[model samples]
Target: MASSHPNVVTLHRVFDSPTDPYVYIVLEYCPDGDLFSMVIDSERYLMPPEPYVQDRSRTDGCPVPESPEYVEERVKLDNLIKTVYDQILSAIEYCHSLGLYHRDIKPENILCSADGQRVYLADFGLATGERYSTDFGCGSSFYMSPECQDGAGRRLTQYSTAANDVWSLGIILITLVCARNPWKEAVLTDDTFREYAKNPDFLLDILPISRALNDVLKRVFCIDEEKRCTVSELRASIRGVPRLTASNYETWERLLQRGLLKASRPKEHAQVPVEKNTFSNPDTNSSPSPSPVHSPPNASWDYGPKQGKFGQGLGPFAPTSSDDSWRILEKGRPR
Candidate 1:
């Protein structure tokens, strides 16, 4: 546990008993809950209550001024995003310095403080020390990098773990501002991601993110892991961003007119289509499909096709069960 880093969850101790088969880990308590809940709450602050409907009858035709309360809430959310994002980046940088890579980076893995002003990066179950790893399809599908997915069945010997972490961070940022995932998975089989692969700017047509943030995501999501933006570059780009979502009513209206931003709120969860049964690998044992774990109200979890032992994949919001090797525990009372 990288407890020295303020943004990383502190690990107090670990207990292993000869009689018991499970190993228990004790971690710092964060009562405010995860970032997914914060994002859901911020959705209202991103836009005004009423849609920006144009009226030609009125002589003084301008968007109504936002209430002072609305302005205050928006400002608070903006500052929170900046603070949490900066802290998360610092935590990742610290981990990378120690020759570690967190394969799972998502809102659910981020814990918040009592005042909602602090965040801690947790769940390093999938983390690895190796810079390059052959563990394909190892993370949440929604936050996975295109190269990591290996949808083409290239049978890649390994992929850069650092690059994969950056890609997942990009997705987390998008969800924070837009309250929706950019795509179901970073693979050609998914229509949204495929469109993005072809046109880097396609996200602008579907999501309500600012151009600056979109530019950052474009670099972060480079198909070539070797060319993807590093954690340092990502921090710089984010600091330069003026706003996460559309800055003004005019910008929001323009996107709406272009059939980009929907009048109603976006769906809480992404609907993934199930694929038909495929031939199982003779070399590996087959198992039943795992039941979709219960997730938070607005949290998104990976339910894509499971890869075989040595197969190439074609395709976290909740505290879902992991493999038998590890488990995390909190010291304080539950939130």
Candidate 2:
């Protein structure tokens, strides 16, 4: 069921292997491996050496850095994490809209681009069309929702697949930002998450992430499945923040291509930052200024990078629910 969505992995074609009784799928090539490796490797690489250490040697210890280099690295890392999270949420929303629930959502199942500009959700073997199924408890233990976990008798409890996916998303986001998993397994049963639940700000207190993200995470990892944020609601909560979307996908691709072409030429190097409006505030009625687009040297061949009519339009910043949500109702149907 793969499509041409930027966030979801693209599937070109499917065929059967004549030599064996297996079906083969042709998928996009992601040289950067999976999200799990990216998180762990980046942390180790970004970790500064010991006292008076100047070499860029890899170490087993993941020590936090406080130097200016660290500041720049952090900014880049945060932006990447935010982008990936937004894309994953959007992809999941799209999947649900099509009556599909990815029963398995974890780092190992996600693939990232080499340049770290994009991520694609992969491994849908456990995906199913039923949203409220209780027959099977499938998914990685560390990222499974409490309801989806096997009980004392190894019976699969009834659960909402959407909520279960949301739980996995929460775990992924926390891991990306903190560069570590807060709990080994069993989110509700884990002491770390229990403490954070008592004081929601505990996550912000530990990680140097934005309060906006902290609020989203708190809603995402709710103990009660009904209370946990849906993919649409989660998208709305972070709608105000700047992110890339399909609407402007072409614009970004062109900018990236141009930058890469320039970067290849010697002595041609520059960097520019794009700025967009924060249309999320409910009190504001003013039209937002145009979003800034730039081409920087770091925008290699594979890389580089709007708020609401405040959630009144489509895409990530689109409102959780509105009349416009039904605007394109029958237009996309093939009669």
Candidate 3:
């Protein structure tokens, strides 16, 4: 089914090495690499003004126009996000049509073409045919849905895999535009996520995304699986958005002045306490490693156990920054 879809990476062949006891799978090449790299690159070059600067500008009255080069680059990036996201949605929609769900749908699983305009949804190791699954904590910590995390300690019997995929997609879209994850995980243990759970529109206060996109994300991130927007509905909503980034500078200025956008600026070198093995099921004190793959040279995994209300294991995790504990897991999966 994946091979039949143009937006999905085609699997060519599978083989086993008789000597090394290993299996090799060949997949289509994506020259520009995964969407994770694209997002990291965008973060370095396209991030919005610092929080302090925004505050100062607000107090000083009004804001200035963005530089011509910055505006041009932002437009290009927004277009790229829309195109790549639309392709991803189409690929997932196709998978759903076949009664298959890609349980893991982060940026790392999405590969890009030479020009970076085209994208192919890759990595189906976590894909499943079941409409509902008992496999809690089945995806990356950053992108997993609340119900999938079962963070409330309710021990949910099962969750809608399709809805879980949609929730992950919402996080991915926000990351594409803001170059940051709204929170590390969806559980109440994470402060950022806790605030979001309390206020469905919390993202509007922090992310630079437009109000139109926020409305769509609210539906996408709905805690109720049955109430969550479907992939097709999400695709249509995103298409109708005029722009992904905030357009009303004056409104943003006012919000900043009133301290409503206080969380908009990330703390510098702040050590945020994170629950280890928060992804693991509370019922069973076991942490399941997603998959073993090489880590990037610049990154390292920390598997040390840290005691927290959620669990006793810290991570087989890579921390993106001291301030934001967003983990990009198993990015080097063979393809």
Candidate 4:
């Protein structure tokens, strides 16, 4: 962890203890606590004035109020969400570049500095290599992806990817927007979670929670790998940055209905055989064949959206839309 990421908290020293059966790791601490604390605090401040009862179930005497000001306070709360989401996306993108998957992503794992400006991704104990068989199962039980758990509650073996990390990100987002767990009413299990995930009733025509934020989270938490918001797509969603012409979120809704990931599973799981280059005739006109076959100069990122191209910088966070409608939502802007 320390050797690969320059921005990550460095492991300056390690100590071996014969008295205990483990090696002690020295980590940097944030005295102000972690993102979990902030989330609890944020939730407290964001509790709904009244429960969002459905129209059918709502009583005649009482009605739901307009969406909270926090949702649109661009400068203060909205910008804060954008900044944290951006930083989180950057950290996850960095790990993906190194082929590392943070299987466990929850409020607790993200640490915030005293000023709350710096958010750090911590707790690598459940972190694992991306390209591995995943039925083995590793991650926070509550936030684990639907694909990870089994009837017996064990993680599946033939799985794990950058997509899983995104799944966790979606859950974190739920915590942020709803100010409470969205699936609180459902059973906390694999089947239960998937059932709810497959059908998160956004109350689209019902009004109330507002459409803009709904559009944003739906894209962020998409289940299908193809349709699921890629890192680049997600980075843009932060700050309500709209890259699409329409912001109603229908395309994402269709994604859930079409379920692109399942159809592409076979293609995604098909691994290429790695041939060993034990002995090659280097002098055998290695440069004679000018077929223009090329390899990337760096593993970090591809410069464009082409086949077989790679680039870490191509994230959802990048700016793609016109600035005319998009603005850095400030506190008073909506607050």
TM-score, cand. 3 vs. native: 0.71
Residues 215-322, model 3: lDDT tens digits: 899999887788999999999999888767774463445465665443422244433222232333234555433322211111111212221111223222113211
lDDT (tens digit, per residue) of candidate 1 on 1-335: 48878899999999999999999999899987887665554332234332233232332222344457866776676667777788999999899989999998987799888556788999887899999988888877667787787643355778899999999998878766655566657878777677777888877665556677788888998887778999999988898887666444544455445654323322235331222223222244444342222111111112122211111221211111121111123212132
Question: What's the lDDT for candidate 3?
Answer: 0.66
**Runs with alpha carbons beyond 4 Å of true place in candidate 1:** 17-22, 41-50, 53-73, 151-155, 248-335
lDDT string for model 4 (220-288, tens) is 555443466767677766656432111122322333354421221112333322221111112232422
Q: Tens digit of lDDT per residue, candidate 2, span 1-335?
A: 64666778889889976898989889989888877667555442122211211112322211123357645555565566667778888889889889889987877688888555678988887898997987545776557776776431234457889888988888787666544444445444555555665777665433334556767778987767778999888877765644221112222334344443232221223222322223123445454342222222221111100111223321122221112232133123232
Q: What overall lDDT goes with each candidate model?
A: 0.64, 0.56, 0.66, 0.46
- All predictions: root-mean-square deviation over Cα? 13.0, 19.8, 12.1, 24.6
| lDDT score for candidate 2 against the true structure | 0.56
Tell me how far candidate 4 lies from the true structure as C-alpha RMSD in angstroms: 24.6
Residue-level lDDT for 152 in candidate 3 = 42
Per-candidate clashes, comma-separated: 1, 1, 0, 29
Over the full model, what C-alpha lDDT does candidate 4 score relative to the true structure?
Answer: 0.46
The Cα error of candidate 4 at residue 180, in Å, is 2.0
Ranking by TM-score: 3, 1, 2, 4
lDDT of 1: 0.64
